[model samples]
Target: MLQTMIMTIVAIPLVLGMAAALGRSRLPAPAFALLLPLFAAVVSIGIEGMPAFPPVRAAHKFPYVLAAGGFVFALVAWRMRVVAPALAAIGAAIAIGLPAWWMGANILAGNSVKATTVAILAVLAIVGAFVAAARKAETPDGAHLLPQAIFATSLASALVAITGGYMGMAMFNGGLAALAGGYLLVSYVSHIRGNAQALALGGVGAFAFAWVAFMGLVATALLAPKASMAGLIAVGLTLPAAPLAAIVANRLTHFPAALRPLINGLIAAVPALAGILIAGLQFAG
Candidate 1:
């Protein structure tokens, strides 16, 4: 418990810092952001010993991970733009996914029904986050949808992993929280550079919703056994609420002047209603 608490504490602040930096800074946030993960990777390599670079090793399939991300930054530099989040995000996706595939596939393969389902969900979350980050990085003009999606999907996967009896739930959950918080902090950095108010609000909303998702997971764990099917249903519906929050944030907070309140309302309302009904079922059961 003490260790978990410490991790949570460290993760939250770090994530918040990263998120804040990403959103507001006119300077090279990606390069700055790269420092932390790069340092981490270096530390990991020191401890693990330098395995050949991914491209050189047969075991490492996503060899171009860094290259793809590096390319984005290079593109930006050539054009004389600030290093973008899209570059780091693309790099991060490759970094996380390749390792996860190599490591996680085995665990996922030897599972019972519930465990297998949870494993699939977790893998999807990891992959989805990668995709979302890449998408957001690639298209900065629009409201950043991918980061939020990544956060949401990651949260859901963590919840499912914890509730479904995965052994590494504590670490997974802690990581999810950190990643989500980081996404928000990064947006704050964007906000500092004169980003729209809605964008910042959207960042905050997504951050808050991530915690709410975490709480739902806790609730599911404690209450689920008593109302298995209903709890599952509640959790199932709640799983997508993060994406809805993102959509609403994007539409309401960051969309063009014309589409603001109307689309946001629709996006927010539907999931809320769905969550409410599902919660009712959990209670009823």
Candidate 2:
């Protein structure tokens, strides 16, 4: 776990630095966003001594599945533009649902019915989030969606660590948050230099949403049976909070444009706080 943490911390900066360099080199925004998180996931798995590809058990196979699915969804969003979220929902449903079904069959054979129910709920949640994110991505000032998604996922991931005692997963989430935050910083630099229009691309929003939803589903699956259902739902709620908050924030016509991000950040933090409270209760019990 300590090794995982160290590797994640190191890899985030390295990947972000490379991403920033690439951004400065006039790389397209969609490619930049898609590649960075994918690279981070690969680096994370490598550092954890996990195989990139293996005919392994479903429990051990989800990270790779999510990574690939996220990339494909991101690409679809980049190319299709109009129906990106719908496409992403289909991909995410398959990627997340298949592994969940496998886990249901193999690990929770005694509770296969309940497992199937959970898998269905998970797919629904992910598809819902994708739709919400897709709607937000269509707005003119949707750049803030990416960072908000990243931050919310980071918080939920940390909560999962608290609930499940999975330090490696926590570190992986931290690395993704760091990468997303760093990318925003780099994008700001690009915007300042007049190289780009906004801090994020619509395609990146899809990628970020997919990544968060995938991780949330994975965390819930791993932790829910052991933890309180309320706590698990609290954590799951964080996945869509950011995009939803962004929608509200965008509608705040009274607020200054420059202060919108800060307001959105606060709104996003609400679900995180709720998650932390639930986690603390679970730990205390």
Candidate 3:
């Protein structure tokens, strides 16, 4: 168990931090970020040995989504010098929505109400993620909101997934949260302080990684034998926390400029912590 934590939690963030630093360097930025999500995916595999070759379980299929999603978004990032809203929206929908369908289709098949409800919520999540990533504050202080959002969401999801009846996915989400934190820390130096392109976190590749991985975790968790929809929904409240943070932070005009990002991060964490608590209560009940 300790070994698993070292590999899945500790080592992953260290590797991701290095990767984010290198990706932000002068050497063809987008290429270095192409496999960023795969870093977390490998740790996930470490938590639970490689899925069957044929992948008989719906959850096993997530590896392919992570790989394909990261690569596709990397290409999009490589080509898109600027994140065109329409194109980002389309990419996010395909990357996030398609994977959700792939994992949840069978799981949600028996209940039309669940299927429709999840479908609508999934759409909202995709749109919210896109808008959050696209939003810009007058200062670079807001540059980290998307990463903060991703980190908070993944952390809350990890706690919720365990109680929601998916320990493997929970471990995987824990690794994911680590990766986001690493990305944020390293990219802060490269992008925020140095004023480089957001190749590591805020860019198209990073946002794609964040949304794809988080949604994939949720979709795959839904396939768990005893998955709880309420827990999943509770953790999902963190999905919109980033933009909400922005809105809330804007209302407080007196904070120091340098402290804005941290303040926004704390705001996002509120919903995340609340989600975890709500999910925990649901699980206990």
Q: How many residue pairs clash in each candidate?
A: 18, 0, 0
lDDT of 1 at 155: 48
**Residue-level lDDT tens digits of model 1 in 6-30:** 5443454355436534543443433
Taking all chains together, the TM-score of candidate 2 against the true structure is: 0.74
lDDT of 1 at 186: 56
Q: How do the residues 175-271 of candidate 2 rate in per-residue lDDT, one tens digit apiece?
A: 6566556655665555556553454445554454446444544645553444444544565555555556667767875876555555666676676
Task: Provide the lDDT at 244 for model 1.
Answer: 44
For candidate 3, write residues 191-227 as lDDT tens digits.
Answer: 4465533422456655665664466446534654444
How does model 1 fare in lDDT? 0.38
Best by lDDT: 3
Q: What residue pairs are clashing in model 3?
A: none
lDDT of 1 at 274: 46
Runs in model 1 with CA error above 4 Å? 1-97, 108-142, 182-194, 197-285
TM-score ranking of the models:
3, 2, 1
Worst 10-residue lDDT window for candidate 2 reads 223-232
Give all TM-scores, in the order shown: 0.42, 0.74, 0.82
